[model samples]
Target: MTASTAFGQAAATGTAPAFDAARALALAQETFDIEAAAVLGLKARTGAAFARAVEAMLAVTGRVVVMGMGKSGHIGRKVAATLASTGTAAMFVHPAEASHGDLGMIKPADLVLAISNGGESDEITAILPVLKRLGAPLVAMTGNAQSTLARHADIVLDSGVAKEACPLNLAPTASTTAQLALGDALAVALLDARGFRTEDFARSHPGGALGRKLLTHLRDVMRAGGAVPRVGADTPFTELMREMSAKGLGASAVVDGEGRVLGIFTDGDLRRLVEKGRDLRGLTAREVMHPNPRGVIRDDVLAVEAAELMEKHRINSVLVIDDQGRLCGAVSSNDLMRAKVI
Candidate 1:
């Protein structure tokens, strides 16, 4: 590239005056070290106050009203979300907004979780009395134990850090990291106290992968009724192959007159038989099928469990049975993939 072109590119991107790769790497490592130490420091100072905060939140009949300002506000939002998803009802309310009208979001039965690094964010301090008067319990997470926010709080969690990762030490780096780690610790404790389970977490995150795995049932994703490729024990091998091809399930279940599963035959089985020069034309499904296939599942089974069964048995498809052991449906690895359950 020409000098003018390079200058133009640099000007367009608002490039810095100098680039020092080694210095940048060193500073990056220092930043990680500082932030990691800050979080570790919080672990050391955490005590009964943290337990009291979790107990207060667990006892709350109403949602946790998380209040903070600036960068603390961002951390508050994440904390609120984590709490809500993990069985604790919580929401973030910006301090400045609360001073105007959002204070109504808090109730007497609710709990307030106030976050401020210096413990004296003007927006937070300005409303401490109002929060107190509202009759809601308050838990403060702050770096300064003697600050106004901490002084007014019912429980104080010390998230203090010695220094920030910033070279100038003006930016909210280590302090904010400490606050975030403290918030996560609080959420984890509350969830454990509440007996929150994986299924409960999945309910709050139905759109995510874990939710799909836990919530999706075999019946929800299985090809049922006529969609299932099935044939009788007396069915000719050609007719069974036709059923498999027509349903495109890659396998066919051999059921009795009562619809109970007796055997299963797959394309793989047919291939092996063909390679063995076995005359399939005179064969019946019962004669050629693998009886009591191990990859059989119930309709009530979780889709993830079905995936596990298929993986464990090295099968591409599974036959689904009802409570009476009757063939109800079938599911393939491709079906699971389409449902995003695998």
Candidate 2:
């Protein structure tokens, strides 16, 4: 095209709709900034009331009953799930459902966490009287401290925000974001206060891959009984290599005549022996075995723990033993990797 024509086309494109992609991104960034600030402001509010909230949940011998309305209800469900998954016994009860006979689910020993932005949700506040009649403690997470929900609660967790990110300041976007973050803060604090163990977390999440990794034990996945690739210490390296190849564990245990593990030999050792010009066909396992290799008791060992042991010893596998030092099982790094626990 001619230069004049090309310039005219560029000018036409520049004026098209007066739109710039960066302007849309700027608006999104502004929204995120507002929400982030709203959450940050909650840090000061978490001082005393946060501790009280944790104390209340800790005092409970039963489940934590969480309730909210509208947007708050969605956030409440997430908080309850997180609390339950992290060792706190918590469940969500719809505020509307509670009015229709579900109130019976709340025991006297349970703790209640109610959520609302304006703190005047009648359905939620209506349950306060019934909750009190049942003698259950109530913790209200709300933006309005003087609102009915806050006034009726046993403890008020202020989740007040300065202003919403919505241009008209009518939407629940920023406020709801703050509330969810605050709820997470509460759940995490309760989790830490209760000293929740990884195993406990795993128990609540047994179906997920993380649970499988943390809850799986060495005994559960290791080759044991007749599956173990082992050979007597006096056995020829040729025989030991055959067993290792057959089992596909890339290693074998060197044990005494009594079948008690005494050492371990691995593929790495074979490579080194070959490099050193040793005759593998004539050598016995006793000549190439790593004496007194690290091991763990099978009755109380996790596969992740075995992986750590392998890492610390710079080895790939370990012979698991019983209290009597007899061979109970064997494990490898690959097993832990397959379980996604290492």
Candidate 3:
């Protein structure tokens, strides 16, 4: 049989042709090119309407209710998560579910963000009249500005892509990429408008490493009270050595009668003094101690700051101070390692 007849038979039987590595590689490269172009295309269309959408979401006293169908629905879920994590109150509602009593989730105080590439998702457009009745302002993210979804919207964000990355030009490839990027842009804008900081983001994600670094304070990781090795400034050098040995902190803080930190004595100092061939007897901590020691930190500062201070000065530990400048605790490099703040 001819090649055309064989090809027709293969199509009819759903039999695949031999795999072509070159064709696959070319298609993958084209996909990247198309999606990248789609995302960059958004920069031109994202102007006043984008700002208006942000303002509306900012002014909203209620959550931003996002709705979409099919692939758009998947993108909507991610958008909702990003918004929620970035300090905006938002949630995703499946368009199909809204017709099935989830419509009650939309309140008059809320602002609805609807997504559809064609501007005419039946599942979304079906509920538009009810959403309007509920008095929530609508924002449409769609490729077709003249579609039904856009017509019903109070604000229109044009996420229109030139074409899909699909070889058949039927799949939601570049379109979905554009939608995702647009959603991220909205979340970023809202976060900036609300003055969301890293600490706030960390609070929203306390289980993450960033939260441990930003939220953990010196007090949380420092050895306090009995755990700290300290002694009086006039204490004999032998007694200071004993304190450092017993506490196993590799160092000791010498304080005054008022519990103010006067100086610090460490193993390094002891070794240096030994190397100098000085008399090893009858030296007081006040004589051997290094006054105003390096790597001092406040208990209220973040643990990450303490890590920075230690790294900057090339010190192994720090003395933690209270508001009145009294020695409250100590933190070592080991402690920072255990806390994973580094």
**Model 1: lDDT of residue 291:** 91
lDDT of 3 by residue, 24-135 (tens): 6777877899999999999988899999999999999999999889999999999999999999999999999899999988899999999899989989989999999999
Worst 10 residues of 3 by lDDT: 1-10
lDDT of 1: 0.90
lDDT (10s digit) by residue, model 2, range 183-275: 888778888888888888888888888787778888888878887888998898779989899988888888887778788888888888889
| Cα lDDT of model 1 by residue, 65-152, tens digit | 8988988999999999999899898999999988899888889999999999999899999999998999999999999999999999
Off by over 4 Å in 3: 1-28, 271-282
Per-residue lDDT value at 245 in model 1: 92
Query: What is the TM-score of each predicted model, taking all chains together?
Result: 0.93, 0.83, 0.87
Instruction: Report every candidate's CA lDDT.
Output: 0.90, 0.84, 0.91
Compared with the true structure, the alpha-carbon lDDT of candidate 3 equals: 0.91
- Which sequence of candidate numbers ranks them by lDDT, best first? 3, 1, 2
Clashes per candidate, residues 3 or more apart or on different chains: 0, 0, 0
Cα-based RMSD of candidate 1: 5.1
